[model samples]
Target: MNKKVVVVTGAGGVLCSTLAQAFAKEGHLVAVLDLNQEAAVNVANAIVGAGGTAMGVMANVLEKDSLEAARKTIHSTFGPCDILVNGAGGNHPLGTTSKPYLEPQDLNSTVDGFKSFFDLDSAGIQFTFNLNFIGTLLPTQVFARDMVNREGCSILNISSMNAFTPLTKIPAYSGAKAAVSNFTQWLAVHFSKVGIRVNALAPGFFLTEQNRALLTEPDGSLTQRGQTIIDQTPMGKFGSPEDLVSTTLWLSGEGASFITGIVVPVDGGFSAFSGV
Candidate 1:
């Protein structure tokens, strides 16, 4: 079989690393992209050490020029991208609200504890929007072009649970991921005639660095917030990085040739449950 070339952005990240490894295991040439050059290289090196073809490239999601350069470098090393994973998005603290609800004290108290919606900084909002929405958009522009006439070519975006329902304290992230899901549909339609599939993965409540504070206590036990999340989820547990691999592989391979424009949730039924 001809080897496919897959590009996974934020390859140093836990989920992306797992996807990259899965692609390599299938004998595909993998490009590990990350803002952190060292970590991306580390993942690529591990793949190479395992006798797989891999290369690391640093590309900032917010920067078009960096993505262009990375695309060129990847082309020189691994040919065109068969599978593109937009996995570089996350939240900024400034874009977050302090609490879930609007309390009466929030109106009177001048304390910094609650960053009201009215006080959301413009830069903060822009940063989150740029990171999650624009970040995914720009990379698709840079990489998916090569997928136009190719078989088994697809784009997988990393969306959030907040996209399905608004999560509190993160209006920017929620809106941005909502945009991401909408854009996935848009791209899928736009690219459908050309054989390029666009889809997204909405992961629910993983204990990654993005949500570590909410999930784990200082001593590493589950926090109250974590327990609350588990109780709300039908599966009553968080997902492991490994849990995402099967879907990732299926989406990237010929098995999912007819599937496109869908955001698959690997959230242990968190999105399906209603806290009942």
Candidate 2:
């Protein structure tokens, strides 16, 4: 590697921060990008203190103008981008149903606890889609221009386990992530000759801050839902932030040059085993 400039969106998130740190350690000029300006700057400062070249940029993935500004700043400072990590994505509660399956008795009953598919707010659904789908698309539009006609350039999109198979309750997220996987393949084919490698990472069941409430109870124990998930997982444990490093590093490096348009699941056999 010739110290290529690498940009990681959502650098404030746990998974993305780790990837940013890994790139920093490898001596690449890192651009830590996030919706939160201060958080992104903090990650960049941490990298700088550890003897790496880095710049912090604030960007809203859904907004084209803001992303364009971010690209200009990074281009001027670190030259063109060689690696792009599309890590800025998440789900919304409004887009989620309270139960996995709808019950007829629950429809007319005004229960404070249950929400049906009809209760899904359109704004939340649109927001989730814009965040995960359009969010991934626009960032690529802004940053990938630098990768065009260049050698050793790649883009990594973050997909979820639900992408391969939809999970319960989060229909919007599942659909959006599925689109991400499909888009990864579509973009890979479109940009093959332009020298940009497009791929995705489907991470499964990490109890990050984003989904901690859904996975665990307030008393610091696994909730019923969490237990069910653990039982289903062949590994019988949740993944740690470090668990994904190997796959991420390999996909970002020259070792994966021939690989593109594939979604590599970093799950503990979650996508492979069907409990039989």
Candidate 3:
């Protein structure tokens, strides 16, 4: 089997780390890039320990220079990246409102650290938007330069269910993810002639480290918000990270050579459900 070079940003995270490991298991030379060098090394070391080829490198998806540096390192280490996964994105507390909807008297009342839509921090909104949208964009700009004419080279952007519809209390995250989905289609169309297929994976309600506290309690029980998600989802449960692996592998491989510019949902029917 020909070993392809696969690069996954945010590979240190629970979900992306799984992707990195899976790619390595399939005999691809996986480059696990993350902002945290130690966390990335842990994931890469695990893959190497299992006798798969992988390397961990520090990379900030929001920074072009950081991505360019990482790209150079990847090219020198494992050759040009045949597959790029832009998985660096997350929401912030300050970007979220304390309540789903604003109340009449609530607007007049004063409470310490009570963040409402009116009080949402500008810096927080900017950070969240940049993290999810620009984070995906900058990395693609740096990596896709190498993939332009390469055979079987593709890009996968990680979007979210919020891209399809706005979720309450998380306007910033929802908007950012929407941008990611839109960018996927734009890139796919622009790069179609170059043979670089660009697509997006809009994963629904996966209980990852980034949202663990919000979704689950320390007692291993689902929070009220989490239960509401499960109730809305047609499958009546949260999706496992492994559930997305097959689709991701298929999309990244030649098996889905004709698939591009689409946002494949791996949300256990979450996206298909309506509150009927």
Best candidate (score: lDDT): 3
Residue pairs in collision within model 3: none
- Give the per-residue lDDT digits (tens) of candidate 1, residues 77-148: 778888999998888878887777888777676785558776678898899999999999999999998989
Tens digits of lDDT, candidate 3, 71-162: 99999989888899999999999899988989987787688878879989989999999999999989988888888877999999999999
RMSD per model, one decimal: 1.3, 1.1, 0.9
Prediction 3 TM-score vs. true:
0.98
Question: Which of candidates 1 and 2 reaches a greater lDDT?
Answer: 2
Q: Per-residue CA lDDT of candidate 2, range 82-132, in tens? A: 999999999999899988998887678687856799888999999999999
What TM-score does model 2 achieve against the real structure? 0.97
List lDDT for all candidates, in order: 0.89, 0.92, 0.92
- In order of listing, the candidates' clash counts read 0, 0, 0
Q: TM-score for candidate 1, please give it.
A: 0.96
lDDT ranking, best first = 3, 2, 1
